[model samples]
Target: MPQPGATSRILVTGGAGFIGSHFVRSLFSGAYPGLAGSRVTVLDKLTYAGNPANLDPVRDQPGFAFVEGDITDAGLVDSLLADHDAVVHFAAESHVDRSITGAADFVVTNVVGTQTLLDAAHRREIGPFVHVSTDEVYGSIAEGSWPETDPLAPNSPYSASKASSDLIALAYHRTHGLDVRVTRCSNNYGPYQFPEKVIPLFITNLLDGGKVPLYGDGLNIRDWLHVDDHCQGIALVLEKGRAGEVYNIGGGTEITNKELTDRLLSACGATWDSVDYVEDRKGHDRRYSVDWRKINAELGYEPRHDFESGLAETVAWYRDNRAWWEPLKQRAGLA
Candidate 1:
């Protein structure tokens, strides 16, 4: 906890990525009231998914700073961890398809890098360490949603690495009494998301008059939480959550790929023909959903925007804010 009238330095790892960048933005925007006395330090490697432009808007803000570094560098992490009151770990190799092609990167970064951070936290930083995780760690579910205590049954290499990190984090908390709080959030969609992800990939394709690729008959269901809502859940855990507990954050709406593609068409003024169904990638999970009762009951949390409204808002952002995303598209050859 931060002392009153003192600016708590909040160190965020992988802070340039999708959800991590949003959390960085939310903190400076006063979205977390308890963090009024907080400053931010983002340590990121600026990988393909890590965009410095996302944080460019807040770079000049008095309380914000950034460094280009890898979390696997234990010496560097330890040196940096010595200065903060909290650690929000959002850095990971998150794409499942990419993981199938290259499991080694996932294991190295998601597993080894996280262990490096946890070791640093236990050795140097006694502040709250919020591990940002994904619901994929619970693997696939045929029907009912997964609670936090559910067994780890990750299917993809990406999810397997995340599960390994979660286990390491939990052990550090239980064995060493380090303050560790974990959050497993559902699929996230919003502005500044990399185009490789489903929503952005399809939306950018639609905007560019190209076909939107639909994987595996487009029936896989996912719970889409806006990045803002995810950032809110993370802040709550860091501020008010008890150590050694897991919380689930969700978007609260279940939509299959086909249904979501239809909605995206409506938003983008495109049609079903614009979607080109493609072969499913290896290890694509059938469905992912989170039961958010724990976060709501424990932290008084509620997502601010509903799916429909957020979808429209996100579409509009991509349309109007092309200046922000266009360069990224060009660099990625999506243009």
Candidate 2:
């Protein structure tokens, strides 16, 4: 796999999602080394989470372009891969609760859609199809952090679908020698996140004098990575990551749901007086922590923001830009 040098033509799938959209901004803003003036074409399906506002910052940038489409569409994928040199795939069915209610869409969007992208990349001779995965694929961890070599034991339909896609990406690399890289990232919270997730849910509920719904005693633990840090890691992989390798992106912030919600309430200037404990969802993982030694040593990557600072910045952004997420909340039936 060739190192993605400065200004390489790249295709980013799902560039409209919370994480993917951040990745697109990083590209145009030149957040990573050797990426200035790089051309990025985002192929998105415009799912509920895909908002054009996410790409508002990059629409007119000289190196940025977007196409509203699904990755599973073989014809469109082939045509795009034929033009770009590298791919950063972030498109998938990501919400665990949605996946629990119905796994069918997750199966189609993650497994089949990734396969379509791989096939197109192979046919078009595209290099470095960076398949984005999730830490949930490794299941629950008690004390130790999960490494890239950890055996996958995904517990939720969302994680299972992502694991399935990661395997397909690796298979394409070994079987056909296509340059494919994989990244498994932990929980992400920042601006532009869909309100269905924990952060936005609690923030909006508090703002509206609604009860903060807590699931399953709120003990589920997850590492929270700022979207910008996640984007930086993805850019590093796209630019210098070794082929057929899996890098873990993490925030190094370990907190349980209960504790996290507490912080969120404080950020919103609310108290625990208005909380609702909801029935725990089935198969919720106990914890997730990424061992970033691989990407750290290889790419010299470390998260730029600490938890407190990042969370404060995140809270401030949401507070300042309620207009950006208010429509999403209403559309999702949260408002």
lDDT, each prediction: 0.88, 0.89
Query: How high is the lDDT of residue 191 in model 2?
Result: 83
Residue 163 of model 2 has an lDDT of 91
Q: What's the count of clashing pairs in each model shown?
A: 0, 0
TM-score of 2: 0.98
Query: Worst ten-residue run, lDDT, model 2?
Result: 1-10
Which residue segments of model 1 deviate by more than 4 Å?
1-6
List, residue by residue over 214-301, the lDDT tens digit for candidate 1.
8988889999999999899988898888899999999898999999999989888898889777899788899998899999999998
C-alpha lDDT (0 to 100) for residue 174 of candidate 2: 93
Q: Over the stretch 235-313, how does candidate 2's per-residue lDDT look in tens digits?
A: 8888789888999999899999999988988988998897889999889898899899899999988998888888888
Worst 10 residues of 1 by lDDT: 1-10
lDDT of 2: 0.89
